[model samples]
Target: MSQTIVALDCMGGDNAPGEIIKGGIEALKENKDVFLKMVGRQEDVNRELEKYDYDKTRVEVVNATEVIETGEPPVVAIRTKKDSSLVKCMYMVKHGECDALVSAGSTGATLVGGHVIVGRIKGVERPPLAPLIPTEKGGALLIDCGANVDAKPSNLVQFAQMGSIYMENICKVKNPKVGLVNIGAEEEKGNNLAKETYQLLSNLEGINFIGNIEAREIPEGKADVVVCDAFVGNVILKMYEGVGGVLLKKVKGTLMTSLKTKIGALLIKKELKETMKTFQMDQYGGAPLLGLKGLVVKTHGNSKAIEVKNSIIQCISFKEMNINDKISKKLAVKKEN
Candidate 1:
């Protein structure tokens, strides 16, 4: 089996070098075919490495003197923070030194670095951040969740196309149904952007465009690939997270309010827990900025070790499945046809 090397941004997330290093070590221990290049301050990385026991050859430490904080301007940070761990990791992917990069850092920085450093694939108008969102029917890929806030009609058509490829290849959803996010099911009931995108997606070949889907249908899994501009997509994503959290809290509170309900909760605790686990963002890892030359995943800024580890493993699968090549071929075929 070919080895998949992933560059880890050690100082990017809320947990910093400690959780990042731990996750990298855990991924290395679990997958023998994976290698890691930990990038951060020398002393910090070395200190973390000493706590773990793994094959020394499978891991390499690279020194990066600067750390880009979440508050820094994304474009400026990427250009100015030459010695930052995130920038160095981006360069590694750009130069083919690493197969992918996983970060729990500033989302803006990750997105900007992906476009500026790694560059987009040929003929790709814009690369959107597509994340697998948990739904009733397993999951769906939400493209442009936060990448391009002001997307054009053509951009959304590409989002549907790229999202379909991702779902089919990575999530194993064949002939994934694509839906345009809109206010109503009727084709004429949206803003100019939605109406234009709906027409384009409906006419586009090689995608399973399923007409308009409202926000309410998203949780019900009305579409396997939900296509929308970043503005709408971001709103939907935030709503999902917020609603999920509130519902979970409400359930827990209601169960604990009465001894009878508490007993009932205990009886179904295992099953309930398992069902809830299916909806967690960590299980699906991070969102990938699709169309980049190399994979760039942005996990939650407050991500813990499990999210980090899963993101690393996610990178391995992306490379192994040859997602980028598949996307390139798909787009090329579209042009030819």
Candidate 2:
């Protein structure tokens, strides 16, 4: 099998070269067919790389002189910070030097660089950031999580199509059910955007459109692909994360409150731990900006080694599945009809 070459922005995330490099090393250890071109300051990257005993042949360092801080304007940073790690890493994918690019960097910069550098798949109206959220039935893909805040009805339809393709091909969900995020389950519940989008999606070919999905029903895994405009999608994604964190902390606190509860906790600890693992966001890795010519995955900025490793590993499946080619073909067929 041909190796999957990935360019990683080692200096972009909060833990930076340290946690990022560790994650790369872990990915290499797990997947022999994956190779990494770690892009960052050569010396700083090497210092982190030296800490791990990894296959030297599978990993190489590409020096990037500058770093794009999260606060800087994305458009201006991409245009001016030519030597920044994020820009350099993105260019690697654009030039075909790498099959994919992974970054925990500035979301704005990643989004801008993905469009400007990696470019979008031909015939794709808009590329959406789609992330997998844990659900009762396993997981669901949340599309347009933060890419296009004000999207057109056509864009939402495209998001549903692209998201379905992703879940089926990469996540191995067959004929994945697609749902539109709305205030109620009824078809006529939402505003003009939702109503118009529902009509378009319902008429779209090749996807299993499952009407509207209320936010309350998301945890029950009512649909495999949840489609919405970026503003709504981002709100759901953030709230999902925040609520999960607080609930877990509260559960732990409650369990430790008294001796009787502590004893009960010990009895259920193993089972509880296994059940909780199902809801962890990091287990699924970062969200991919679907409809791009080359793969671009954006992890959380505060990601640790586990999330980093999972993000890199996530690229292997995307490359192996030839997701871009499939998306291009699907969109081209839609255009022809």
Candidate 3:
């Protein structure tokens, strides 16, 4: 059996060692072949770990001198906190000690560390944080969710290629169609950057470039992979979450207000619950930054133990698919000639 170990940053996030510990335990209980190197303060990790009966032999704590806070700048923190758990865990993956790295810390730090410390692929111009967004059909991948806010046309073109590769191999979307998030479907629409990107994507020979996709069609699952600059993509992500939250709250309030509605709710509650579960963001876990040298998953800072658990198990699929090697091979070909 192949050795699969994931380096988890336990010092970061609000839940820190507590939820991280629980996530590790759940991961091991679910997958006997995988192991975890929990990186954080030894005492804190041990304290939280004592609550679980997980395989102690399979879990080990890697100590760090400091913790990187959300307020600090990512570069300075990574450089100054040389012995910090966040930086150390990334090095572990960079040096080939682990298969992947998971963190629920500052998004800036994770993205900076992933691209700078672990380094990008051979020919990748930029690393995009591709996350699954809930859609009316199910969910779809949104590339450059928050990595590079201002990207070039070439950058968007590259995203299409990388996103295509991911959707095909990892996401299991055969010949995944690509769409450029734009103001309109007209070739003349959008800013100069998007228009230039349109030209590039239109010429691309590999991916199936579907024309411009409007934001309204997003819920209809018009495309399998949606590519946009970080600015727009981040807006779309936040809007989806906020809208879903508001809708759910309104629905719950309506059902609880009256006895008649309560009885009606009991009748339709099961269907509504299943519908809510289908669009649940927590169940999808975190987003993986594509085009990195190794698998680096960035979970939401507000993620609870259950979300973290699902995030770790997501790594199992990455390992089984050998995603990194496949990415490297593509980058090599792109770099050569």
The lDDT values for all models are 0.91, 0.92, 0.85
For the record, the alpha-carbon RMSD of candidate 1 to the native fold, in angstroms, is: 1.6
- Candidates in order, TM-scores: namely 0.95, 0.97, 0.94
- State which candidate has the highest TM-score: 2
Cand. 2 Cα-lDDT: 0.92
Q: Model 2 — which ten-residue stretch has the worst lDDT?
A: 276-285
Best by lDDT: 2
Comparing 1 with 3 on TM-score, the higher-scoring candidate is 1
**Poorly placed runs, candidate 1 (over 4 Å):** 263-265
Query: Candidate 3, clashing residue pairs?
Result: none
lDDT of 1: 0.91
Residue pairs in clash, model 2: none
Per-residue accuracy of model 2 over 1-337 as CA lDDT, tens digit each: 8999999999998899889989999999999998999999999999898898999999989999999999999999999999999999999999999999999999999999999999988998888999899899998999998669889999999899899988998889999999999999888899999999998988888999999999998889999999999999999988988999899999999999999999999999999999998888777899999999899999989888889899998899999999899889988988999
Instruction: List model 1 lDDT by residue over 1-337, tens digit each.
Output: 8999999999989998899889998889889988999999999999999998889999999999999999999999999999999999999999999999999989999999999999999878899998888888888899888668889998888888889888888888889999999999999989999999988887888899999999899989999999898988888889988988999999999999888999999999999999999987777788999998999999888888888888898888899889899888888787787
Comparing 1 with 3 on lDDT, the higher-scoring candidate is 1
